[model samples]
Target chain A: MTMTDTNRQWRLKRFVQPDEILGEEHYELSESPMPTIDDEQILVKTLLLGTSPAQRMYVTEERTFHIAVEIGEVMSGRGVGVVMESKHPDFEAGEIIQATLGWQDYVALTPDDKSDTGKNVRTVQKVPNPVRPLTTIMGLFGQLAFSAYVGIIEVGQVKEGDVVLVSSAAGGVGSVACQLARIQGASKVVGIAGGQEKCDWLVEQGLCDSAIDYKKPGQDLAAAIGEHCPDGADVYLDNVGGAMLDAALQNIAVGARVVICGMISTEYMNPRPDGPKHYFNLLYKRSRMEGFFVFDYVPRWPEFEEQLREWYSQGKLKLVDDVFDGLPSAPRALGSLFTGGHTGGCVIRVADDPENIPAI
Target chain B: MTMTDTNRQWRLKRFVQPDEILGEEHYELSESPMPTIDDEQILVKTLLLGTSPAQRMYVTEERTFHIAVEIGEVMSGRGVGVVMESKHPDFEAGEIIQATLGWQDYVALTPDDKSDTGKNVRTVQKVPNPVRPLTTIMGLFGQLAFSAYVGIIEVGQVKEGDVVLVSSAAGGVGSVACQLARIQGASKVVGIAGGQEKCDWLVEQGLCDSAIDYKKPGQDLAAAIGEHCPDGADVYLDNVGGAMLDAALQNIAVGARVVICGMISTEYMNPRPDGPKHYFNLLYKRSRMEGFFVFDYVPRWPEFEEQLREWYSQGKLKLVDDVFDGLPSAPRALGSLFTGGHTGGCVIRVADDPENIPAI
Candidate 1:
């Protein structure tokens, strides 16, 4: 493959308003001469970019998140890339790896330099083996899956006979969490999603025993949850906070574990919404609610990857990606995370597999 | 001493309204023939009664609590009593004991008969080697102290060098929790109370390093907590929920443990108030919030009592009771818990120590 002389990129235009939908308007697309690698740097071409609800915080006007992107700087994101040229001994051309590739076609990375993203996973690292339809690497074996691992296995502690409930069930992390709960011997797995389609997709994919469509007309969330979980949820994995979290709290069983993985619904709202009205249940039921950042388990990522990869190879887990072709689709793809317009792992595919890489 | 043949009693007049204060009007005083002991039962005369904020839930019209008091039935409460007559081998006529004596002059108790009060501690048990002023048993070595122990030690996992915070800090359980945090090697302890007097009492009694008056006009609770706990609270024992819990949440350090012991602020309200608005901090700070019912620790009470007694004997702990004299003051004493009209462990003195009991 021949390398291009110019690189296309998207830069932050302004910070997002709390209630605003993140879209192309918040970013500007431009072209620049390809960047060159210095003595200890490597030139890498982006292959696929992952989208997360947390990305919106990086561009907020206030420093809401640890990692902030100033206006005019490249919009920050994580992605898989192929090393094109290496000035460092540790990396070689054609080596597949992952890092904070941002919203750009190519980047010059210093492997030993620490990332300011507040995420250790953003540090440049080599991908052991290349897999065909590389979305599998971004979906089943990437940061998204690690988040699911920590939230469901480590924090949620989903165990045998547990009745697990998951919010944002059709989203990337939620999808994996549902499956992990089942694999861990959950008696039942219930998923809550925004539309009938997503709900149907969840059950059809065997990701949940039952699915509750949150958008049902005049839906009474707490009542609906009670109907599905007559004995109450033994473990609740919350992705979309606000009302959904409150509803789950009302139906938790004794000694329930409520895992807070994300709060997409109210995270960006300037005046945040009220907390769960039924949090008092935590005391009534002798339960606990805990939150964690996947990055905090950086030292154990390898152990998590080993278990996840084993499950994938044994046909116990499957990769699900909603792929948007090309770098230009990045912003629109990210906006879909909050709009409920996409399912599975939302990702932007910037390029095809290199000639000699074997397809899985 | 002479035993009276007439018994004066207080019965429930009506269920309490959500927002109403518990007072004399809710109870009616009447006279009845003295209760008699059966073959396996014992008759006991009330000595002193202990009050807790949880009692309000027992009288709510909606059966909001596990143990409910029916209208016209004797009001439920726990107190210290002395046996007047015995029918079983384990007890003698002059033995002092603790049990659910209710709001009455005398009671017939079947020691082995299980209590339906949803509390094992309420079952009839001998007060070993009774101490004079017996208030010491209720304040420093009873259920109140047990609640504080579980919250700060077992649940909160407070360790040395930690900064601790307590709400309702001058109240029964809160007062004890502040001292436990110190004994556990906390570097600093801050207390939040309603009035300047209570605040001063907290620091003056050495229960807190500093105290915050939450009733200060136009006070921003979060700001006040931040000023006293500039580095953030590592362990927060919350007795009053609602807005106070929200304020504490805003000032928690990473990995902080917010123990929800009670939610007296909104517990009796028909329409409970919104939950803490800043609960999202549980995620932002990778923290945990847990709730526990003290009764769940019944099996371990003896263990807790042994340790608490050791501390009291070592002068590492002190008992503080806000006493109201006479059985006629029971209603008012219970009411003071909700009105913030009393500090320390609130208790009612029905009769003085028997002539033969030695003073401490």
Candidate 2:
């Protein structure tokens, strides 16, 4: 296969305001000559870019997460790509890989770079084997899935007979979390989503036993959670912080684990909103609330991936991807995370899988 | 010595309002006939009433904690007393014991009540050995010290080379928690207390390596904590909650453990203030925040007490009690917890140790 010489990229045009919703206006499209590889470097052609709610922090004026994207720089992101040219002995052309590929068509990577970020998932590595419908790599077995594995199983400690509650239930991490909780022996899986449509999708897709429509007029979140989890939720995975977290706190059982994987609700808010009002429940019920970054568990990613793959092959886990076609749709796809417009794991398809790649 | 035929007691006159400070006005002192023992029961004469910030919750209109006090009821409390008479084989006259004796000069106790409250520290038990300056039993070896133990050691998981922070550092649980963190080999202990005097006391008494006087005019608490814990606190034992907890949250180290021991700041308020805004740090730092009731560790109290006594005997721990003399001082002393009027573990001495009791 031949590679394109022209690279189209999205650059951060401006930082998001605290009160603003992320949209296409925050980014600008530009063109550049395809990147070239030096000795020991590999030239990669982007195939698909994954979108995370956390990516919003990259464009914030302040440094909110580990990495920041400067104005005029290619918006920082992660994606799957194929090595179109390789000067490194460990890599070969045609090999599929995943890394922090940014929102661009072509890039050069030095696999052995010693920067701190380089030591994390940001480092370039070839995808093991190859899978058709490349969106699976972005949605099921990639960073998003690893995050759900850590939040629901490791941190949330979902166990037999547990009643699990998940926020942003139809989103990438939350959707996987709901399933993992059930697979981990939860007696019931309850989800909180922004609208009736998303809530219905959560239950219909078998991700939740019941779903709370948080968008319903005058809905009392805590009461809604209580009605579903009368015995109290044994594990609560929170992706959208703010009132949702407070509501979950009110209904947590003794020794409940509140896993904070993300705070999409308050991420863009400067002088962030006041925290959960009922966090005191942590003490009252002798419960625990912990937060984690999936990146911190990179060393154990393989362990999580193996189990998740086993579950998937056994029909115990499901993959759902909300794919936006082409690099031009990148900005809108990322924004859809916060807008609650996506149905599952959100990804932008930059290119189709090469013919030589095998299906999983 | 002959016991008085009339018993003096304090009853809950009214529940407290959200914004009002606790004081004598919320209680009424009254006279009653001395209690008599029945089969398997004991009649005890109250020696001292140990005060806790949690006592304020007992008088709140809404039940915030496990046990509640209703209007016209003798206020519930824990205290050390002498076994004046016994109808059971296990007890004898002149033996010292501790139980939920309430705010009264005499109380009738049924040690094996089989009720939920009886399963906890509220169950009457003989003091292992009588100690002179009986306030020691009320402070160093009682529920307050047990709370500090569970918070700093079991929950906060304070360890060698760790920097620990304690809120309300001069109060009952905080004072002991500070010392426990030090004994657990914390590299540095920073305390938050209301006044310059209490802050000074925290450092002078060797309870903290340094103390932040939160009452200082224009004091920026988060900044103050950052100055003392430049690398961030590894363990934060929060007794006051509210803004103090938020400030501590802002300055926690990676993997920090925030132990919620109490929320004295908002306990009396009908509507609690918003939670710590910077709780998101829990995720950014990959930390954990947990809360516990010392009563939940009832099965392990003896294990905690053993280690505490060993520390006390070795002079690695110190006892500092702010004693209020006489039954009449009970209301004012309990109020002192909120007003920050006491310097150390607050206790009300209803009567002196009987002459026949031996000193430890």
Candidate 3:
């Protein structure tokens, strides 16, 4: 049965330029009625909404869109949905699918629609699973885990007993990488965080062996790196790539590998910061630096998902997620990122997945 | 017969800032007679002077001693000299050697010294080859060739028919990389230069299919990159890394490899230039960017040198040197680099190596 005015669709109002006004109004959530399913179209009921820093950038910043988003368009997002009714033979009622379903209660899709979600979207490709609750594809286990994995395994090529240095260690990505390095057999993992609290917790929780707080003014980063990693860093997973990258470069052991995952400092900059000029250190130490993105391994997701799932199942990998409540809370959740306020991965909980959310 | 002449040496008189007096003028060429040769030492007559950019910064500008070159210290350089006397086992009567012979006509050293070059030092490792001109080693065929080779083959991993982009294409490293890319089976090599003259010469010399003058104002770099490379670039050998690197990031084909050999623009700055902020492209394209030093591949020198020698012997890779005629010309020669005045490798010719220089 179709009901009109039962649910409202939240939409992106307009693209904001750098100097333009940031929107002050709430999302235009109009209680739109569900439509009749056509012969080719399947009706979808969204189970969970995905809200992220990326989503906010895609909506308000405009820089995220290679193609312009329409002013009155439905806000873009990905969601897990259950088919309530289906006219398409491929989809059946109660079957779950994931798609770019927007922030709404329901959606009708044709068989040939580009946004159609037929296959299982349970895990990010290359990002292993069972890492769900403590961490999963939804958080650092999925995305940032891959970044650290590629940085250490593929680019950095970590070996047994190797010292690994992670910057922004208390943050979503860095914390997962610290754990992953250990699971991958790194001898020691040294974390660089912004405060004493996170630093103390990272060591206490067994995620990292040692931690250093960078917030103390006049703190010597190189000395700290050297002190924490006496054997020197064989692999460096760089999340904040400014002065931290320079410190890593300076203290790198021979044949060291530096993996560039993200440079948050450079992102919001009107003009980027000047990198260190003494790159000759790469020559002196015979070390290597490489940059990576997790998305490229989409073709090999099944392998990673299964492997990480085993790790999660066995308690080898922890799924650490800072779960927020809903769509409207997205901005505040993301803003916490810049201040180093969250740990593990940050995700939004759309609904109580009675079957999946696990009644505690 | 020992010719007794006052031995002279240049020294950085006192500590000064980057733009301060680079020269102290009180170069006390030692008033004492020539130094006595030890059992392992060889005395070689230096005919010309070679100046390196790093030497200038070390002697006059840089204060932080990453690698300290103190005031009153004997200036260091790679000098080409003819061995007049050898108490050591390795040298022959009239053999030419490249050694750490400082900035002087004569430098005394033992056979075990790191810079005791009795053969062609193509890279960090010395490979003996008697048939080629001595100037080939002193000119573009030695250390610089190593820079180009490492950048293209080892770092860029350039394949047959791949489109390669070379920044500062007509400069020392770039010139060598251009020729090497062609020899290693690249289908197209586009050169990026600073002026119309250098661009024309690069194309005319067949080092590049075409040359782009980046100095031209209002040149839409992204458009230019797109236009020149109709298909995306497979290999990018970066020399100019600030904005050019930013543009190159946008035009990479999937699985593209970028070899960061030199950031010439940033090197000369007192403080380094702005680094690229939107580095997430590395993740988006699944492309790889690596920073390489020619010296790091010391063990693989034989493998690369053999290939380079074959390419040179077949006339596929041409080595060109822009020679400045005198000792005083060293400053001007170095200064010309920042202004993009030299079209190829800049070499200081203090003495006429008529036996070697005329062949090219």
Candidate achieving the largest TM-score: 1
lDDT of 3 by residue, A1-360 (tens): 233446557666555444332332424655666766789878777655443334445554535433233567766665555677888777777665655666667787664653322233222111111222322445533445555566667777778889999888877677778877888899899998888888998899888999998887888988888888876788888777777777777788867777777766444444446553334455445566667655556556556656656777788877666776755554455556655767766655555442464411
Could you tell which candidate, 1 or 2, scores higher by lDDT?
Answer: 1
Which regions of candidate 1 deviate over 4 angstroms?
A115-118, A130-132, A355-360, B115-121, B355-360
Ranking by lDDT: 1, 2, 3
Q: What is each candidate's fraction of native interface contacts (fnat)?
A: 0.87, 0.92, 0.34
Candidate 1, residues B136-212: lDDT per residue as tens digits?
88898788999999999999999999999999999999999999999999999999999999999999999999999
Q: Measured by TM-score, how close is model 2 to the native structure?
A: 0.96
Clashing pairs in 2: none
Is model 2 an incorrect, acceptable, medium or high docking prediction? Answer: high
Give the per-residue lDDT of model 2 (tens digit) for A235-351: 999998898899899999999999999998888777789999999899788889999988888889778878887898899988887889889999899989989999889999888
The ten-residue window of minimal lDDT in model 3 chain B covers B118-127
Q: TM-score rank, highest first? A: 1, 2, 3
Using all chains and alpha carbons, the TM-scores for the candidates as numbered come to 0.97, 0.96, 0.81
Winner by TM-score between candidate 3 and candidate 2: 2
Which candidate number maximizes lDDT?
1
lDDT tens string, model 1, A1-360? Answer: 568999999999988888899999999999999999899999999988999888999999888688889999998898999999999999999999988999999999998888555566558878887556678877888888898998899989999999999999998998988989988999999999999999999999999999999999999999999999999999999998899999999999999999999999999887998999999999889899999888888889878888988998888888877999889999999999989998899999887767545323
